[model samples]
Target: MIDISQLNYSSADFWQQLTHLLAWEGVSDAAVTETVRNILADVKKRGDAAVVEYSCRFDRLNVSTMAELEIPLNRAQAALNNIPVVQRQALEQAAERVRRYHEHQKQDSWQYTEADGTVLGQQVTPLDRAGLYVPGGKAAYPSSVLMNALPAKVAGVKELIMVVPTPDGEVNELVLAAAAIAGVDRIFAVGGAQAVAALAYGTETIPQVDKIVGPGNIFVATAKGMVFGTVGIDMIAGPSEILVICDGKTDPDWIAMDLFSQAEHDEDAQSILVSPDADFLRRVSESIEKLLPTMERQEIITTSLNSRGALIQVADLDEAIEVANFIAAEHLELSVDDPAEMAKKIRHAGAIFMGRYTPEALGDYCAGPNHVLPTSRTARFSSPLGVYDFQKRSSLIQVSAEGAQPLGKIASVLARGESLTAHARSAEYRLKS
Candidate 1:
């Protein structure tokens, strides 16, 4: 049912084919940046009034005051109580796992004293407040609430503010329930560039946040890009991605559905399968045809596969690793025999789903690793969202009189070489008798 591109490692044009597939055509055009610029400027100037007006115009919600947009704790708690028992249990379990995993990632402050009495180390501290932006237009992502807020909480963030748009005043109880479970300090019923501006610039009702984290639409991404220097932001994530390296041992249907999991995200998301078994590649393609009709988002998956997906035939697992490293996919699943051994060869990937039993969907939800990962080959240099992202490090230094004797000379030499007389004099003044 899908017409995904097929490539073989031995082909002369394989590199060109791969490069063409990797290209991202959605450059933020001048019109989008101009619109984002206008929104940011308007929100900055008018504050709460501009935010309310934009919400009314875009979300179709007629509200006059900021208090009407503030969601109370009782409402979030009520949502938590109203959800189905099974869903609640699953959410609690996932939260517990995510919390447990992140607790290990928490950094601590330490220092060491040298013989000359110089003390140097790093002091780790959490941000004062964090803003979370969860997409609420098409489908609600409660997992996002757990993923973004829990890490901030674990990192000792003083306060957490969450913003989810209620289009037409329709709020998703699952999202509220997850926010309640995640311990979000405050909740706002606004979204898009207006919400981002509020968090970046601080409106009358919404306090400014030190960093904003989560996923959003193109407009929200643009706003985050524009306001990054004002307030820290998580990466401007591209479309979801999943790359599977199969050794032809796992079920072809599982591989087909694994690809579908990310492809179903949107028409532009990418899904790739690299395998040594050429016949297995054909079988998986047939499985794709057989199973594509059963999916609810069949149209999206089909387009994504046909446009951005690929089934590559490599000579061996080693060559597959080479291709995967070059791609630096957002989600890489190793459906091979010795996944741990194969993983040592991979240097670039946002997250690695080890072994055939592990699927990328588990990581998206209950697997305890952050689903907010690097995309567009940024995995080559970037990392996943974690407790460390919400925390900062300050270099600590204290030079005793004896210690300054040697350090002052070095500082003076460096400062004079750079022609900074004020710095050289300052260091010279610290020299010991």
Candidate 2:
């Protein structure tokens, strides 16, 4: 079968082996970086002209102007109406669920008054506009539209612009339908580094957005990284990752298929299974061998499993959690007897699929949680794409006459200690005589 790596947690070099397996060079190479840098500069300088040129050159379109590149609202609505009834219903239901779920995450402005009558608080407000990038053409990800757009709408963003590349003039109706249902303000059939540049720096037609969310290829990722300071980004996501902590209770076939789910995403995607039962680990291996050949993306799954996948034999479930924390995978599944209890100890993971019944695929589509999660080890520090990502907070501070003296003295002292005469004087002026 499949030549997936097997390791033991008790081995002295287990940590080193895990580190090597988890390592993925996400940074763009110099050539790709330079190409993205040039694209950003060109698009920023020439506006729609550069975007149009790149779109035609890269996407194999012959469109002459940016106006031809935009998908009209009527067309988007038509897509929603023309699609299969079941698909439309599914999109609507998913959109509603995503909207409802993110509604709870919406931050509200709040203030509190001190005893001295000073006011301090946070003012929360949505962004003016946000740009979303969808890998288009043959990439039929209506879920991406729902996941990225609904949160911004829930946060009350005034406008949302969507960019999806239609390579070879092929368009995905479901993506358009999702855009219509999610209330995307604008749709542009342009993608890649040029689309990112057009979003970062406003063009003749595409308005620059306050932030950009969604996923793309290496070129798009590099462009996002380069233009980060100019606008906000969700995260520079890595390959898909899934780590399953099984206590040998779940079906071996189910576990094998679950690992295959993420591995099928790409050849670089990673899948790992940790368990205390050596016999169960062997059973899962057998399941992978028997089940992989039946998969549609068998070649991709094979390559991914051969290159990055692992079936680790841990000392026990406790050690499994320890290894899970060290990995900080993008998606984690607790397929054990006490999933809830094991989940309570999980300190790092982009999303935790608790219980054997809860599959990670649900979260990817209609689980009422945004599937746009922090990949790689970023789960340790970052979070999933949520309404909060589309909103900003401003600290509120007000000082009464009685409160000014004490605050002013504190500020003056800090400013003077830093050797800033103007800053110290500005605060000192508010001090009582």
Candidate 3:
């Protein structure tokens, strides 16, 4: 009885309907924007005092000073030591895999000397410090700690600071353990726009970070957007999305659960299945109905599917790919005999999970790929968070005196053409008369 939308490719208004379904405006309302602005301004002005005040007001913490809000590294270590053996092992394994995967993304500095003795190259360097935001309290996301922190650590960031909100003094042991495993240097019990402001502008206690990465609620996202130029930030992600292009050969139950995986994230999360076989789509719909009651997050799954999920009937696999490219989903699954072949045609997607056995959940945890991906059709332009996000490149150029002559003449002409007399004269000075 799930009221998921069903779309037919042959329908005259199909494209329009699809477009409407994909549209999601993630802009923060004026009220939220203004509130974030005020919070940022206050934190910038008052430093630790404003942060402490906001934490007491918003997080309901009984604290008088910034010292009370800081969580020590030994606490994270203790949490790691005390967690269940199996859970600890799982965390270690996941961390190792994530570390190994990001190591491949580590960039190195390179240089070369030209025939004219002009040295030109690129130097790669990691950020001095980074800030990570984790959702805490009732929600525990250890996987997020691994995905965001490991990449920065791998990129050789000198310090990694983590801020998690612990409402009413509630903290998740697993999150603390994950922070220990990920090597986060400092931990602060703060959240919302206030925490973001502290990271962007620097409180007396919290050091300003070169870049801020991780996920949060509407307020945090709004704050990140507002302070983007002040400090680098990851993309403003929208709700999670998964698009499955099936060949009607995979088990309907597996495919159904795959779609449910993203839907369970929240009511706004989108899940769509595209296939040529009408019978397979029907079977998957039935599977969704049957499986709904068994899930602990059944209500959330149901609401998500009913509101934004879809089961689309396409003319063939080719049409399905066309729809996928148009949607530019965050997670794309090609559940077919030849997923590799089909993946070649995919021009846009945050991450592609190939074959029937592969699911989006695997990528979210231990698949060795980053789960921090672009969402809300941003996959077309942006990419997932990786070691590269924590690193920067600088162009290296050292012109030899002899090499400067020809280059100086070229620069002089271009500068003069652009009516930049100072630039032209500066370049002319290096030229032989």
lDDT of 3 at 315: 94
Across 1-433, the per-residue lDDT of candidate 1 in tens digits comes to 6889999999999999999999986557899889889999999999999999999999999899889999997899999999999999999999999999999999999999999999999999999999999988567999999999999999999999999999999999999999999999999999999999999999988999999999999999999999999999999999999999999989999999999999999999999999999899999999999999999999999999999999999999999999999999999999998999999999999999999999999999999988899999999999999999999999999999999999999999999999999999998998865
With candidate 2 superimposed using the best TM-score fit, by how many Å does residue 392's alpha carbon deviate from the native?
0.4
In model 1, the runs with Cα more than 4 Å from the true position are none
Model 3 lDDT tens row, 1-433: 5999999999999999999999889999999999999999999999999999998999899899999999999999999999999999999999999999999999999999988999999999999999999998987799999999999999999999999999999999999999999999999999989999999999889999999999999999999999999999988999999999998999999999999999999989999999999999999999999998999889999999988999999999999999999999999999988999999999999999999989999999898999999999999999999999999999999999899999999999999999999999999999889
lDDT of 2 by residue, 1-433 (tens): 5999999998999999999999999999999999999999999999999999999999999999999999998899999999999999999998988999999999999999999999999999999999999999887799999999999999999999999999999999999999999999999999999999999999999999999999999999999999999999998989999999998989999999999999999999999999999999999999999998899999999999999999999888889999999999999999988889889999999999999998899899898998998888888898899999999999999998889999889989899899998999998888888
User: lDDT (0-100) at residue 263 of candidate 1?
Assistant: 98
Per-candidate TM-scores read 0.99, 0.99, 0.99
The per-prediction tally of clashing pairs is: 0, 0, 0
Q: Provide C-alpha RMSD values for all models, in order.
A: 0.8, 0.8, 0.8
State in Å the error of residue 170, model 1: 0.9
